[model samples]
Target: MTPRDGARISGHQYGAGGELCLEYRPDNWEPQFTGAMMIGSAYRLLSGESPSDGEVADVASAHRQTVAQEVRNTKLRLILNTTLLDILVEQPLLQAQPFTLDEHWFAKHWLAHPRRLGSPDAPPIWAAAPPLTEPRTREGFAIRLPDETNVPFEGSYAFLNTILTALNFAPALERMTASDAEMPLLLVHRGTARLYSLAQGTGSRAVYVYRTIVAPANEQRLSAEHGVLADQCVAIVGCGSVGSKIAATLTRAGVGTLVLVDGDLLLPGNLVRNELDWRAVGLNKPDALAARLDDINPSTKTIVRRLLLGGQESSASTDSALQQIGQCDLIIDATADAQIFNLCGSVACAERKPLIWAEVFAGGIGGMIARSRPDLDPPPYAARRQILRWCDDNGIPWTGGDGEQYSLQIDAEKPPLIADDADVSVIAAHAGRMAIDLLKGGATTFPNSAYAIGMAREWIFAAPFDTYPIDLVPEGQWGPDADENARDELGGLLREFFPKAEEAADEG
Candidate 1:
């Protein structure tokens, strides 16, 4: 059935849009979904036919969860912090308790601008059921029903009057509504919660309750089912377009700690491919990325090191930053910079850490992801050299040298194809997946340590999604080969730095 303009109807499972929210689609559209059938479903629903199981479950779920809500007319916000949620869950039904109405409570709980607080024309009334403070708190009442099956109130006055009558309290509905004091009535059915302000000046005005807490076991269950790396530590060295994205991906996957090392500022042009936006524009890349990571998962701790590796930075700070990167379980190089890669290679080899790096090819055509594990493959530098050799052998002109964002700046003959954010994200996400695989340990997803993934038709890629797995031969030992005499000299320096535990104990 077609809906008419500005027409409102009260019917089962029908929203303001006049479309039936719940219905069935037949396997064959032509024969099963005729006009008669469509009208039959609507008629049954409007005539008080029982809603399908899916519809009943949807209502029950919505009623149990407290999400962000707002008053349509007054534009007042309803806030429910974790503290209030805990009390509400512990005691489903509570008599009218003291609640405070103030603007300061809203300011402290949310991240809104002062000028944009509440409504624009006038100061909006804010209320907290269990007032965050005690000095200005007032008495409030609330109820927690088993479900929303038999409640019968249509407006604010009716709701308050009904609630007071059921609780056998002296009906003060008039006194509560006529005054400026905040008497918020919290209605909870099963787990869903709604808040109605008695002093809102509008009938049936319930401010939406924005529940500000996540269930603890919800994240754990999600991570456990997906083999999440919740206890692993990872270090990402390039908080650019690729680096920032990798950081966010890992954080969202429940990685416990991330060491973010980047020595650059988020520029205006970086928004094209960078995960960060204008809010982070002048901030240091690592600092901004740390904040972004926090927004994704607050439990994921971040150690930000704002120092450019292999640059003209102070030697002490550079070495300190490298030391932190070496301590991580896995290291990812998203900088696409040779100098930074070289420094990371040195740290990865010396610390016996796993390394994963990616480079998006010129234009958004494709990218490469390479990894070097301690005993599984050659060192980071050797693995990279082999990737270069594979490119040479395949007659694919290497297009990864120019230090640009996402892609290299090719000559006039082969004009560089500017890669969009999606192109960079593709490679970055693969790098993040490889990082997770390394952190998880044991069986790996990528049989080959290096892969050239094609996003578009270019270079060796004949069509999109053409993946070439380059086999990297692990040649020589894990660390650099040293002469016997030089090794003896290095042993003496190492002994000076770290004495035997027994020797130190004896000396003490």
Candidate 2:
């Protein structure tokens, strides 16, 4: 085989505007298959013609298959069932003239549910119309069908009405004056109808509205696998990088309601590792995260508490917050603050709810995720104590401790933490998975109740992605032990304050 002039071929990942990526065996490629030949075949195929003769039969077949797949992948923008247009289609016949569909028709006759956008460049915004008695007017024209021919590929208004004119149904077509050029024109062909938006100058283009139903967020297909998540309520403390990401993960997984607890502003510096963007800057973290979670899944409700837990709040207020957190199905302490963890631990143990927490190490080294269930693991403080001992036994000097296993926030005098977004995300995701497992209840995905995950070679981590799972055994029961001697002495002393039973009965 001989290479063509000006044909540049390199192993670079990217290519120029006209760069052609051709893969072939240098020693066994067909002599006739040259760069020019391939480009010519591509051009011919794009022009809706056979690429080449039998010299590239297999290539042509593969190209056709790819084109067919692309066509199949094309999805419609608007969605409405054929049944919705029956009344509008029949109204023109009763009036014996072309008619306009006002907003009332859209509101009463059409049903709509908001469609979730899967990507940024997804289809146009959906217009979901569920029947309401609201009187809203839309500039739209409707006409009776001409015949039962399949939907034509040509979208020109003139070309389509020309068929109506030939069928002697031109009266309605003539009624659509230039003033109504902007309105959508509906052409009914018996059971099916085609909608077209007539632009002022350009030819009309078909608005492909599918005749299918849209399910609400809770009823979406994801509900089948995540129905448990939809019914579970979770409270997340500390709406920072880890907390916000975990909240988003749970919301996307269809958690019914999130109790967001935080008292920090989303500063610009937080964007590098936090899930929130610049739009949330200066806003309270809990409120901002609530809005973000709604955007992710509208069905996931959020209750925002913009108070710094264990941080200068009134005892009454803190107790109220803890009471609310305890009511949730699960509590997540992403704060990694020892004091906050202790508060949350008290609530979890008293409420008999599951508690989960995680922390990303400084310098993006690694992180740890742990959970404590009332029935299985010890209290939150005891669990942290065990993890700290585990780290010490493994010779991993724990630098992040406020008399606890780890601390998410460091002192202002020390160097600033340096964990990147990816590092925080790794820990947050693991924490989220653990939360979901706790909510699902029964068999667990993670047998161990805690783990120390390494993202780089630091501390006890020998290599990147090193993981150590630590099993937690149940500790002693809660509350203080009773002393028989102290009880007997206190009983004799307290007997002085109260009357004897015989004297009390006589007085009564």
Candidate 3:
């Protein structure tokens, strides 16, 4: 049927089906009268009678169809959209507002209702049944409406739009119309209320305050902090799991600009722990990570380079990339590539920019954070040498170690020593945490130290004794009474490794 015919049928059905009222509150008297006339003309058109004004009648018929289509489309859309909005808003509101749900009502009704999408095993959307109260809390309304059996038109669009426009304003009703993938009807309503309140008032209230309690003073502080970070820039190397996470976390944290460098592409194997999905497969790692980061925080600027640092192919661009890296306030090394680590460390130290080095063992059991503050002298090569010496002494292996014997041995002692995709997520999360701490300079349990957590065994340890200024020697050093006893414990091992050198020193 033609849209006009459909509208006439709908209008006739609506008027006869129930007690319907149409009120016109136009801004001016002329418009109010005109609107009333239009409604009368629309009724005549529905009854198969043409009005006196041919032009007016034609316009009225068109208007009726447009309005009817919108109302009809909204009914189905409202159920799905509102449900999504309720889910998004409830969590935030329960955390911020004093709201409760009628769980018994929901469990008995909506829980078993086939209309509700998502897994049945998923936790209840509402914690408890909403308390009986006027001017419902944001979360209370969001959750309670879902369980309401008497919703207008079974929570359909036509009924929702009518109620919304009648109770609220036309603008408010307009905002409720969003696409399927967007938030639900109830959330849109709440968001519109919030936006209206903020636009009309002091502009200090939270945009989603009904979902969460946020003070004006806190908002001001956050704004100021963002202003400071917005002008700051960072450079991140090695867009692997840790690097990808660091990039994403920094973007979310409001780092103004980011430079991402990586030599690989997303592969099926990488999806095990990486933030990217299968769609990102075949995409450059740096580009894929940068896109994801931007998706989360569009305000952050990103520059991606898909080339291995210091490689023959990257030789010409290396200088330019290093110059950009030099300009950043912070340079992060998450590649776990020894060569790249040394190169970035050298450049950052030379340029006097703060450098953060993070690495997770193949299985993510052991990770380390090394930061070279601009004010402090560069971390001595001694630490890197010490690591190398330890690796040699312990006979530890690198990624993709030899067959079953080596793998079995490391698994028994340090399950994380072997590269595994499962460990990527753990490494990413830990690396992001460490990077944030380094950037903010906060007290951490393992600040400037290497930490090893055995996931299988649940053992935690901080290496190198967790001492500060391990590189510095004090002028007034005093020996403890048991110092000699402590020395004796290492005497045998030291002598065994340096017998001739110790004898020469003693002779001198």
Q: Which candidate is the best by TM-score?
A: 1
- Ranking the candidates on TM-score from highest down gives 1, 2, 3
- TM-score-superior candidate, 1 or 3: 1
In terms of lDDT, the best-performing candidate is: 1
Which segments of model 3 are wrong by more than 4 Å? 1-228, 363-365, 375-377, 380-382, 390-418, 441-449, 456-508
**Rank ordering of all candidates by lDDT, starting from the highest:** 1, 2, 3
Backbone clash count, each prediction separately: 11, 6, 16
Off by over 4 Å in 1: 1-9, 12-142, 145-185, 189-192, 197-228, 396-417, 479-508
Query: Residues 432-488, candidate 2, lDDT per residue (tens digit)?
Result: 999987887778999899999998877888788899999787774432212223334
**C-alpha lDDT of candidate 3 relative to the true structure:** 0.49
